[model samples]
Target chain A: MKGRKINPKRFEIGQLKIILLILPLVIFMGMPIIFIINHAFKPMEELFAFPPTFFVKNATLENFSKLIKFSDSSGIPLSRYLFNSLVVTVITVGLALLLTTMSAFALAKIKFKGRNALTHINQIAIMFVSTAVLIPRYLVICKLGLIDNLLAHILPLVAMPVALFLVKQFVEQVPDSLLEAAYMDGATDLDIYLKVIMPMIRPAVATAAILVFQQVWTNMETSSYFFSDDSMKTLTFYMNTLVNVNNTVAGQGMAAAASLIMFLPNLILFIILQNKVMNTMANSGIK
Target chain B: MAETTKMSRKDKKALKERMKHLKSGKLERRYARMGYIFMIPWFIGAAVFLAYPLGSSFWYALNNIRITPLGRIFSFVGQGNFTQILIQDPDFMIYLVDYLTSTIISTPIIVVFALIIAMMLNMKIKGKGFFRLIFFLPVIIVSGPILGMLTAEGAGSISAIDTQSLTSAISSVLPDIIAKPISDVFNNMITTLWYSGVQILIFLSGLQKIDKSMYEAAKIDGGSAWECFWKITLPNLKSMILLNTIYTIVFISNNSENPIIVLIEESMFSGTKEKGYGYASAMAWLYSVVVLILVGLFALLLATRKDQYEKQVKRAIKARKKEARNKKKIERRNRRNAKKIERQRAAGKITTHTTDRSDY
Candidate 1:
């Protein structure tokens, strides 16, 4: 795949032009994450420096050890928060991808009563900001007595409209003949959906999965709003609390470490799936 | 005997023909039922989590809402809350203007920036995937608090060169009005780049879908690269551009750190339950109106008539499918109705004259 030559006629831009144009942007974008990662290893005094030290003089595990020491006096241990984030992110993202992909199939492939109407309704939901609905959503959660419950946070995002929309756009590219062939062989909608369509739209799934996983992962505000229980707190919530607590020299170092810990999984995931994600996104078959 | 004799000959023939298992509409309905079943989970979730909450926001906005000791209470207050937020609240108005301005300002910059990067990536560049990865990496790391912090000083200038001095130097050379936004985009370039992650992906995908022959055809016809882009690439990307615009608007405006959102939250949680929730909901509604209008304007600018040919093709395809479905539906309905009459006749419920609709 790597050695295959690219067609110059594709975008008709000079190689140097692309390089010159993208260099500034890539440098601008990549620098901060590098700093954040480097800052995590700094000793306490360096963390406190203004016009902050771009690189730590000496890297140490003191921040993480300090984080552990501080958590000893807290209501829930830090590891529990990490576990909470992991459990919720995995389940919610999985459920969201399944539900959205299935829905995208039905809406994109199957013609039924009210199909257009339903798609439009969901599109309108896209424009209508979710923040407006927060109070009511909170009330809806409370009415079901799910307050202080992790389920409360997870349930709301399990049917993601944005992800569904993306998958639908991708699934529409799936040849109708494929579904018809499945139908000819006696595959039901559910069967076609699970076996045939889902496999075809893998890139959309990856894209949607990445999106939802990030949403669930970096989520700090919503969890605090819904769940007051300490044990149910997410890693983001704990990190926020860690960052805001007293702003001590040791605390800043620990906060940096926490940022790294929180940032690592996503970074690792990005490295793994980004190419597939880009390919899927680019998979729109215009030809 | 007379009741049986009074039955039309047409009905007798139809009923005689109905005794087979080929009443296909039932089977089709069964298929539809399966489709509905497939949709049920999303429908229920959307109703409960999305629609119900969306509807309730308007209700809460209109009413005087509060949490009572026993339960939540709502009294109709008409436009009282709306008026208060738009007309009375100073801070809400200020934040509203700021958020609205930011969204209006940022939407195009992000979309165009993403489009350029996407087209750039589409070129025959070495390390295409590498560049794509670099563009997309920020998406994963940019959300939640880290992004919020990075933008705040958010990812404050990590460069040793004084960002303040840099901006002032640039500002001194250029007019302040021109300098402010240019500096701002530079200051938030990382954030801007991060925001474009998905947009770039979307545009790249849209670019990929462009048929190779369109380019070949243009090339054969003596179309230059710039002409080909305007005629082929830009037109093809119109719908995707429209989508990216709305997405950027919603993403940027509704970000947790947006002062407007912060104001909405502070009012909802920190203000008294009686006054706070209602006013907060009203502000949120105002926020919704602004977002929708901005989105509407973008859609109009990018989407108008660009997809008209595509839309007609799609509509033609849909219309054909609908006609086929309707024909099958009527056939099934007629067959099923004929079967029902046969069953009723067998059960002795049809003791009077009957006629086929076709005969009538």
Candidate 2:
């Protein structure tokens, strides 16, 4: 794959064309994120300027300080919401990954009755629009007396079928002969799964984790539906409240700041795990 | 390598046989038991979470149910909710049409954009990782009220362009149908780009899987880049395209801005609709069917060739005919054996009474 550089026939467009194509696209894509950061720092005048400026004219810490005060007024410290969100997201991602890997290994490597049924269920679940399941899921949460608890958010989504779907596809690419060889070497199925299959599909695991984390982190619907407690509220919920409720002094800027704060974890995860994610084994077994 | 070679082919065959046999007896049950053990968590999760909810929703869609302070009330009205959604609510039908049309138009656009970007990024280049990060960052950052605030009016419209004038100009010159969708495209350009983030990643991963030699061979054969792309790249991207299409459809259909979804939401719990739960459930179910149909249509349109269809038909026919032939052969063999046994019994040549069943 790396051999083509010697010939230098990369078949790329001219430099100007490449620049033209990439530059505007990169700008358009980055503008919202850039604007979010700019909005965070912009003064009140700049933040509310007509049509919105592309950059902050007079950068200030006033909005951030105001945001700190806003959290103070709410009585539940900002750290409480932040801590709850952090704990929920971390546990959700870990549990989701562990459970998904187990089910995926069973579906992909082990043969037993009901496996076909499970596979079909996952396929159907992928097509499932979330809205259809929303009311019932909420009702189920209510019935289980799990409302306002963090588990309500974590439990419903941790066994998501998409993670299972992707992992199963990747695991199928694992050679049956390799499995047999491991068996002949006196490895139990669990040992082979953990030591062999897991390492082999790290890229897939990372991909699933990234996706699962993104879903849990950015989810705006769940906390609202399930938790009404101020104490149980997440950073996202707090931000939602800040954006909608506060049309007062330095409101927009603080919302932007809160958005940035909320976005930081995703940004960090993506930046750190970017390479592993792009090497996803989702398409490895495609015909 | 020499040690492996020293294990003769016969020994290898024997080993395989033993392994095959080893799967039975105590080991088979052990693996099956372990499989079920591993499956326990998922089974519990599915039963409690997925299956129950999905089944209950389907049930709710069929009946009029209300929530009161005391307890829930259920009054079964078979297909009444569906009928009301389909017949009485002509307004819903319009939104449904609008939703389906927009999804049909936008799904292809997003998938194609993702593919083009994927193809471009697949070329080895400097700062490729940086570019990938830039493209995907929006997907992470842009969501919830922040995303809403950005796309909302006045303070932070995503684009600074005079969209009103641009859309008006486009509408003035072109027919309304063409103008509306075109302007919609221009208006949603930024939003669409945001939506395409994960899709680009998915497509790039898929593009990475194609053998570099395929492109090299095509180039060696004097194929232009365009030709090589259409032949090699697009065909290989077929599955990923299907995946992205499904993802985009499901994603957009559930967007908060979707009128149908918004309407359903209002009816369900918030509003004073008489049969809120049932009607909303009905609307959701109908909407899901539409989304599914659109996905199916994309899958059909993007399917590679009719040749595979014909091959499937031929295989089915051959299997049916072969089964009949095998059945006929078995019947003839059974009849012949029965006749020989009867003749032997009639001739009294068998001293022992076999009872016509050859246990020996």
TM-score of chain B of 1: 0.68
Q: List the candidate 1 regions with Cα displacement exceeding 4 Å.
A: A1-17, A72-75, A145-150, A175-187, A278-287, B1-31, B68-73, B124-126, B147-190, B212-223, B272-274, B307-360
Number of clashing pairs per prediction, in order: 9, 0
For model 1, residues A97-162, the per-residue Cα lDDT tens digits are 878887888888776788898897787787676767877788889899999887886899887888
Over B111-193, each residue of candidate 2 has an lDDT whose tens digit, in order, gives: 88888777777665556666777788877755555566667643233457778999899989989876777667667777877
Score every model by TM-score: 0.78, 0.79
* Stretches > 4 Å off in candidate 2: A1-19, A175-187, A278-287, B1-35, B152-179, B211-232, B271-273, B303-360
Candidate 1, position A154, lDDT: 86
lDDT, candidate 2, residue A65? 89
Q: Where's the lowest-lDDT run of ten residues in candidate 2 chain B?
A: B150-159
Q: List per-candidate RMSD values in Å.
A: 11.8, 8.7
lDDT for residue B78 in candidate 1, whole number 0-100:
89
